[model samples]
Target: ESGVGKELVAKNIHNSSDRAEGPFIPINCGAIPETMLETELFGHEKGSFTGAYAKKLGLLEIASNGTLFLDEISELSQRLQGKLLRVIETESFFRVGGLREIKVDVRFVAATNRDIKKDVETGEFRPDLYYRIGALTLRIPPLRERREDIPLLVDHIIQSKPEFKHKKLSGKAMEILTNYAWPGNVRELQNVIYRALFLSSGSTIEPHDLSPDLTSGLTVSGRRLEDIEKDHILKVFREVNGQKRKAAEILGVDPKTLYRKLHRYGIDD
Candidate 1:
């Protein structure tokens, strides 16, 4: 649930920490590729390897005397966990293909959506690394747990959207949004609002503008092929603003597939 608020919290922690002047580099570990993750975080020296045309500094070196925010820290592989432990313990690392050891002064602030303690117990994650990273831990409760924050978050989201500046949510729509169990968390809420913003022609966003997927709960019963097809088509349609060409570009599908979906869904020109 690392949303706008979580980022703000991270920023506040960094700003208040001793190394306020240093850079605060935020990395989403879960999103980065396993192969490139090392290179991306710990930069390489020129000619260190193929495609290493120029010398690059790693985030750890760049955040010298600063804070490094590692989001989704649990996603790191066992090898990466070992490397990270070494860096944390020694505050030094050798750049890929570089001979010299580079020292850094950095405070790490990591966040994760997984149970790291369980990971450590299961031996998927190193216990020593866990102890190093958890010098300070802040647990951010999910949106459902903090129901009182819903209205405030919704208002902030609406105000943040440029297209929805003039639009307002009807009381009923607002109620629906507030009461719904937000499984996707704050990110899902933002997407729902954005969807409503585009779909609503009037100044007020209504319940009808929301995607059926958001409201409809998927059951254990196997979903129909037609239902899956419709969902995919609808998603692509919304992404491209009902444009066949742009939808094709985004979906990486041929124009014919997009056209077929449009026809299949009975979407009018």
Candidate 2:
């Protein structure tokens, strides 16, 4: 759920809406410290606080006439939740340490991986805020549930990387990706693709190019586990310009072990 492309969905919504011409602002509620998050949302006047050297506009004002995406909204503290609820209701808020209330016309898009209903029941999140934001809910399924989309997502990711423009996934490699349980979702898949591209010998990404964790105990191209290990060792060795110590560090093995493996694979140097 963490890497299920929630922000992408929010962007799609904003781009297709009437407010497409306006700024699309996004902030992760969980990432910012509580003290600073308030100022970030409401802005501050010059000399409003110790660091207030110049007037500043907050995300609320910046996203006026547009969309404000609040990622991980459930992480907001109770105080901020109350303030946000007030903003949704009144459509006006004062900047930090400013007396004049500022009005904003902003459409809010909120997302969270947590079970917000449970959180609200447990008194962690405010119910009033939840009701306002939950009017229209869109649930994105995990990668494993929608395995068919992996190929399309993979292609999209590949096309985005300039170096991977000429690279393509082998049929067996694609099968392994689609079948693997992607607990980390699209993020993990992207990382795997990048890793595979770095380790792959040719234009095609084969099953052996994938991280060992993903292909463990799985045979493809009728290659034995030892052969897979040999191929991986040789690839790492070459990628590091035959620097055994660096290759060993990358492979998480000692230099002596890598040397022994190289010898066993009948590879000199």
Candidate 3:
């Protein structure tokens, strides 16, 4: 789900909106440590803490009149979630250890790879905050589900990179890419293409240029356990058109086991 390009979608929304002229700021909540995340989002005032040298502006202020993309927002702790909910409800927040409340007109776009609703139900996420951000939701399917977009995406990636300007994917290579179960989604495809570009001797990328794990079916000696299982299950699931029972039968596993695995892998249906 991560490599599905949620941030890209968020940036597109921001660019297409009235705030296109304004700055589009992005932050990964899960990437930053919890201790620093609060300061990063709300900033700090001079003398607020040991390292607070000057009045620092938070993303909330910097993204004023624009969009603040909160990627992996589900990773926010409950305390941070409450603080964020308050700001969302009031459109204002105070700088860390500051007396004055700073206000900003910011469009929030949140993304997560987890089932946030389930998180809320399980009490891991706040329900009120969920409703606030859930006013609109968009689901981007994994690459394997929408194989039609592979060629276009491949072309886009190729054209975007100057080094690969004259390079092209061979028909067989494209076929292998189109049929393979992309467990890593678009990000993986991008990496594979980039690797092929570098390893390719000529202007064309061939099937053999792809990584062995991606091309070879005879061996799984070097592949990660989860990756192999994910690929096999996804292949069977797709073959059965997402019929869990049939897939379970083919996989020699129970329907519930198959369902649990699919859910764990973030596969829809």
Candidate 4:
């Protein structure tokens, strides 16, 4: 649900709507700290707080006459949720420390992988705000449910990568990808393609070039997570030609951590 390309859907709607000319502002409610969420959404005046050096526009004002996409909407604290409800009702909100209420004409689009009903039932989410945001709900099926799109999505991802423009997935590789349960969804698929591209010896990427982690989900089919990690490290080692720095980046870790893992895994690289 997290990596089901929900942002892409939001963007497509914005681009096709009458507000296409306006900015499509997207905010990840869960990513920002709760303390800063207010200022980030409504903006703060110069000297509003310690770091407010100049008058700044909030995302609501920025998306005036446009679309404001609040991703991970359920993550918004109750206070922020109440404030957001007021904005939806009045179409105007004040800056964090500003007295004046700024008016904006913007459409709101919210998304969350969490179950809003359950959250609201548990009092974690406000009913008033929930109804406001959930006026129209569209469910996006997971990648496992829509395997038909994998090849097309794979092609889209591969061709977009300049280095893999000429690369193609071998039949066995495609079979493996098709059969595996993508717990991480499209995002995981993209990573696998990138990893395959890195390890590919020719224009065609084979099954062995792909990360074993793809199969790590199914206990009966794939190796354990540790083995997947080991194979992944070895593949990355070969891909970067022993460049620890680059390999670390590709693996999403610091050089020191990468070094320690390599040592722990008994990898020379």
Q: Clashes in each model (backbone N, CA, C under 3 Å)?
A: 1, 0, 0, 0
Return the clash pairs for model 1, or none: 43-58
What does candidate 2 score on TM? Answer: 0.78
What is the Cα root-mean-square deviation between model 4 and the actual structure? 15.3
User: How does residue 17 of candidate 3 score in lDDT?
Assistant: 99
Q: Who wins the TM-score comparison? A: 3
Ten-residue stretch with the least lDDT total in model 2: 216-225
Best by lDDT: 2
RMSD of 2: 13.5
Q: TM-scores across all candidates? A: 0.72, 0.78, 0.79, 0.77
Evaluate all candidate structures by whole-model CA lDDT and list the values in order.
0.80, 0.90, 0.90, 0.88
Flag regions of model 1 displaced more than 4 Å.
1-8, 16-20, 214-269
What TM-score quantifies how close candidate 4 is to the native fold?
Answer: 0.77
State the lDDT at 27 in candidate 3: 93
Q: What tens digits encode model 3's per-residue C-alpha lDDT throughout 31-71?
A: 99986999989999999999889988899999999999999
Quantify how close model 1 is to the true structure by its C-alpha RMSD in Å.
16.1
lDDT of 2 at 206: 92
Candidate numbers, best lDDT first, in rank order: 2, 3, 4, 1
lDDT of 1 by residue, 39-146 (tens): 877889999888889998888888888888888899999999999999999989988788999898888888887889999999999999999888778888877677
Count of clashes in candidate 3 = 0
lDDT for model 1: 0.80
Tens digit of lDDT per residue, candidate 4, span 100-216?
988889999999999889999999999999988888998998887888899999999998998669989888789778777787999998998988899988999987787867545
